[model samples]
Target: MEKQIAIIGGGIVGATAAYYLSTLPGGQQVKVTLFDDGLGQATTAAAGIISPWLSKRRNQQWYQLAKAGADLYPQLIHDAQLGTDVYQQTGTIVTREIPTDLELLFDLAQERRQTAVTMGSVTTLTAAEVQAKIPLLANAQPGVFISGGARVDGAALVAGLLAQATAKNLTIRRERVHLTAQGQVVTSLGARQFDRVIVAAGAWAKELLAPLGITADVRPQKGQLIELAVKDYPIQENMPVLMPEGERDFVPFGHGKLIVGATHEDDGKFNLQVDPTVTADLFASAQRLMPSLTTANITGTRVGTRAYTSDFAPFFGPVPDHEAILVASGLGSSGLTTGPQVGRLLAGSALYGGTPDWSEYEKPLATYLKPSAE
Candidate 1:
């Protein structure tokens, strides 16, 4: 009697869970079926910037998990032979004059007892420092601090994970899933009974769990990005730039291109339309940060939905009252930064019995074992 687990969604979190579950101790006996309707389109559409230090938060659980995931990226890239260039470990720079709430960030760092380097009086960078780091920013303002960070090709990572899962004999079904009252899951293709079912459906987790009497306080937040082609721009080596006090991030990617994003809108629209207003704002911001980008060719634009939790933390662990039903959603903007660790934790919990204790990572529906009155 081998254990069987069904995971819904093939985004970062779901796919990572599938990969880890298949590699768990004595995992050979466990069969994992991964279901995804969109298949790595939603949450995986992120810029894939891995910055744990920049994710400064009041909650230690999130900080810990984010750091853990960041640590895992290097190894994951190596294991997949995805090339070191696929991940930029050039670190991140947060400008000082960006009206950021440094008091909060410093307080969080202090609470976590993490070491932070404070450069004197410089709230922003001078044109020289900016040029030194990112030659493209020869005309940028002053006040900047560098933090340890990394950026990865998020889409490539997803593709590599799926390929690896296939090599390991895991089943991936591209279809929607409907769940039964007895914790069974049926897909458009077929029905299967699992010892455990993990719902990692991202934005749609709430809708999928509704019929099962489980509530996932998750929503879709639309974000957009623009790709720029700059063959000669002197972009920083693997460096990510945060702007407007961390409201958005600018990341460089493969083949002399950069990704400028994103707008956090709660309009619940999934259309890939790049809002002109948003794009203008993004372009202005990017040009201001890196002047060399002014000559860069606007390659293309894309829009994707991020799964957000009411409390802005991921939903992991088992669904209350249904021991066999588990959840792994609501990763929000940090899916790429936290997916690997969350997946490892969820896989361990599913195969074993106890959910990993991450008290500070709040899930909105964790307290609601039953649906609210309709």
Candidate 2:
């Protein structure tokens, strides 16, 4: 008899896992099903910037996982058959207000490149060079360029992965689901038994694990991003992702479009409402960085909930006492960079029947998913 596998959540992680389960070496030995609630999922609403080397966050394990996640993009792109419109290595620009800070970052990138050869090239851009790269900038500020940086469309990526998985007979249901203490998945239709269940439910994992007396350390964080239509600016298509030292990072897509945003609201909870004041503030920041944006039209806004832990670290593996139940969450703002690798690992563990050795990537699974007090 074939093994049965169920994955909850159709965000980047679950989608990628399903895709891998359909393509991995022993994947054909199991039957796979995915359940997606289609709520305020962060992947679809994300800015989708894949540049993690320039982050100042002081977590070595997190950094290692992030770097590895970045390195795996080429294989993932090829395996999933993603097109340039879905994922592109257009490179990234790191701009700092202080010239000395920019120089320091350039040096750091060079040092990191010794181990991360896939980072391509690192260069400090002169004022003229900065302008030549992105003419929309109000000031030709000094910047550091990383040739390996890339961007992805989260929704498109999930769609692409699911498309491939479905071709391999992966079942998908667009409904909310919960789990019984015995590791049974209960959807609106009915309960179903699976040899293994992977919970990749993003911010909603906390509530999904509650029925089993497991209190997930995951919490919902609200994020919002805006899209601007820059008329007649064909060059915007080739523009690199902009990483300013604040919340106003910018990502450009083809067809005269640019995305700016992502407010990390700790207090937003599970709220998905769009706040006009926040949107206005984001546009103002974008205009300050690129004055030319003042003439652009506000095309749309995207709001989604992201998952975060108290320590702001991500974890994935089997639940402590429930070996049959695996979970992945707390990705925070870096989900786009790390979700794919986490998904691949989870798929491998389910197929091989053991806990994934993520010692170098995060704390133990018990630290994030544990039983509630009696």
Candidate lDDT (C-alpha), each: 0.68, 0.87
* TM-score, per-candidate, Cα-based: 0.85, 0.97
C-alpha RMSD between model 2 and the true structure: 1.4
Q: For residues 43-158, could you state the per-residue lDDT of candidate 2 as single tens digits?
A: 97876788888788899899999999999998899877889888898889888768788878988898888988768999988767877887666665778999999988888998
lDDT for each residue of candidate 1 in 1-374, tens digit (9 for 90 to 100): 68888888887877778777766686887888888777336655666567666554666667666777877777767765676556656655555443355445544444433432321122335546755665545344343444445677666677777777777747888788888767779877566788989888777777778877776677788887777776545454544444434335677654577777767788945555668788777787777766656634677777777887766777677787777887877777788888877887788888887755666554334543356443
Poorly placed runs, candidate 2 (over 4 Å)? 232-234, 294-296
The C-alpha stretches of model 1 lying farther than 4 A from their native spots are 98-127, 143-147, 233-247, 291-296, 360-365, 368-370
TM-score of 1: 0.85
Candidate 1 Cα lDDT to native? 0.68
Please give the distance, in angstroms, between residue 295's alpha carbon in candidate 1 and its true position after superposition: 9.2
